[model samples]
Target: MKKLLLFLLTCLLAIHLAFPQPPAIRYQVAEPRLADSLDISHYAKKRGLRAGAMVFGLNMGVWTFDRFILKGDYAYINMHTIKENIKHGFVWDNDAFETNMFMHPYHGNLYYNSARSNGYNYWQSGLFALGGSLMWEVFMENEHPSANDVIATPIGGMALGEVTYRVSDLILDDRKGGWSRFGLEFAAFVVSPMRGLTRIINGDAWKRRSTSGKQFGVPNVSVDISMGIRTLELKDEILDQGMGIATEIKVAYGDRFDTEETKPYDYFSINANLNFQASQPVLGQLNIIGRLSARNLVDKPKHYLSLGLYQHFDYYDSDTISVSSAKTPYKFCTPASFGGGFIYQYKGLKNWDINAFAHLNAILLGGSLSDYYKVDKRIYNLASGYSTKMGADFIFKKEVFAISARYDVYHMFTWKGYSGEIDWRKIEPKTLNAQGDRSRAILHAVGLRADIRLRNRLYLTGTFMNYTRNTKYRYFSDVFSNSSEGRLMLTYKF
Candidate 1:
């Protein structure tokens, strides 16, 4: 495993160093016919294959990295600067320095000869820029945030501004910052690290490098309290933009774990989970998500349209829980999942936003260190339920400190990759008592998220989530299972 990880990181580095193209390398893009002897088909095939690999690797890594990066740069602005500076300014940002000649963000494509050289419609450039900027947030975690939800991350909160500009171009019929562009940009940002990790970590295996200690909640308020200590080590930077170096060994500790008792325990159990992302132009977006949930532990969800870069709501993002009595030995620790999908956001609205993204949660292989981790049968088929969510994110910012909120309804989708109900009991026909197992899951959820500033670095956030499921099966005996869980959280920026 260690060797594979090391190799992947190295390959990611090479791809980013070579291709470095942005705007999702439009498949529709007509590559000007080269006068040289190189076959365009061969070149395209190789590029696409490598791009897909790197995209997958970085996405998997970000699946775990995105969780801890919620500490917005604004969190620092509130801490280092005076309350009045923040109060008067309202919004916190490291605006373009005097040296910024291009109208783009710092990490944006500055090459005058690149595809963007011709200039982009709003949605085209907007998505890529926002996606890149958000990816930069990975290394900027100075505090803590939620582990399960990506939008809860500070990077997510602030990315709204960048995404806004991208969205504006679309509603106006300007494809400049279109969703496609945002997706491509996000991919560029992602590939940089995965490739670099290949050059950084000396081993081929992946591990959950740390745990979480942050505790936060806000049950009765417009916004839940988001508070914790999230951390990541800068490991590598293979991208020319000086952004792919992740030398810090991405790690986290003390990310709290919580369970919603309203129904059967619905929560994430964080056991110091860790993962990596390759940042090559073609390799950077690939991600590898690690162990269970609860803390802003695993990486946060990535943006829409950027497939292969693990998403905030990826299907396999969580550990699989069993409904049988035999007790799968791996239940205590969080389960790790591997899957991929994409996100697409619509433009044409000021604060009214809509996003559509999907992912597949393959199989959950979760367990503790000592008792689990066997060779061969190491993975448990918690394929009980799969989740798909559709929602809209709205933004309302007017100098008083930007405010944004998103609400999503998650549908529990099962049958695909489902292991069926755990019938721990095997009965004989002569026993006169046979009970086959059955399972049914509603897998529906409603989530609401918000962020506000009482002043400066002193910010507040709230999140409310509810998940419910009902399962029933028949045999010699009838079995019915129903569970509902809700999490309310609050945080105060230091």
Candidate 2:
């Protein structure tokens, strides 16, 4: 649930940037007063305070957006890796292999083990993430964080926040707090629902209680399912013709060891995809494609599958520890989803003129990676994600004339923790015991490309991106605010 909330929140952040109404273009009247003394200590202290305040303010703003906009979002995405993808060198390979990830955040296996602990709730911590995210927006104003964005964000988030808090209180007292406040505020930025009205969905207090929401994975069962259709191939005519169908599913469950030392959130997942296509289509110029997927659904969600699993570590620390302090990944487990759709298109413009698809995916993957452990997995559908921008695509030049963008603001719906007990490693080899676990990090990508003729069948492309980040037990869900760069590739064929 936390993961779903985070993903939806991130999507909202992007939407907030491009709201329907243009913001009042306000120019900075004057620079805010900075510590002039330049005394190193005073300067540092001043900066720290400013940072904290900005963080708080920004968080407040985003949360407000949730209340006003999306109302609340329910995340539905697959976060798992198939053994075949790994064997085929398609998995996200960092430093570790054959590891029990998600144990740290999902089950608290790496951090607390057995000592039951407790701390801040979702609202309090959300305040922290929002504060920081907003601060960055401010800094980006006129400069890196943007002051205009900060102001607008707060206005939007606050209006939504007030309504959400009052509503939560009016109907259910137990569900009111920083988490729901944060959830409602953030949800708005993603979906407007209506001009002024708000949509309230997924108020799962009962589910929260049943799952014991936190960072540790203790939920008894987790059922994740995804089924849809699309076209990998296309026909020259209509979009529904000569297409394909596809589906994928996964599930997991575990308990026993409340923390890493004694036991861990033990579980497994099954993922499968099926596709079928026709040989030819309209004008005998295209082909048909189809896909199907099936996954077993369980009645409950595992601790790792619930919202509280990832933040479980916060319960044991003074403030909060890093997701990997204990060396557990706490990701890589998922439920099942199997379904597929179709599409059709034509060719021969520039590189090829075409039209195609249905029920596509706008998939995004994430987690963490560091020197201590790697987490790039458990990123619901951690593999290369391809979203439904399943429309007609027309390439004007060679493949190099690639122009692709997705504007799905109107359609579709979207999409941890630990224990402390004992270290089974002491008595047996690692794999045999589920007592303690960890997940580990980074990729560098740079690509530059040039188009070549069919005979050469060569292209030049370059892309550069690599980053390492640590998610604290209480870190904000919208942390794409912290990003770095790294890698490169180019090719020429003749």
Strongest candidate by lDDT: 1
Q: What's model 2's lDDT at 134?
A: 44
Q: Which candidate is the best by TM-score?
A: 1
For model 1, state the Cα shift of residue 278 in Å.
39
**lDDT score of residue 386 within candidate 2:** 31
lDDT of each: 0.25, 0.24
Instruction: Name the TM-score of candidate 1.
Output: 0.28
Candidate 2 lDDT over 1-494, as tens digits, reads: 64564344333222111101101111121232222232212212222333344344434554456545755331111122223222332112221211222211211110110111112222332343345434333322111232222222232222223222222222222223567745643453232221112112223332223211223222333232322332221112222332333332222223211222211112212222233333311111000111212122222222111111110100000011132222221222111111132333344343554433343332122222222221332221122123222233334544434322222111111112223343324432211211112222112111121122232333222111112233322212322212211111122221
Q: What lDDT is obtained when candidate 1 is compared to the true structure?
A: 0.25
Q: Give the Å shift of residue 317 in candidate 2.
A: 29
TM-scores of all models?
A: 0.28, 0.22
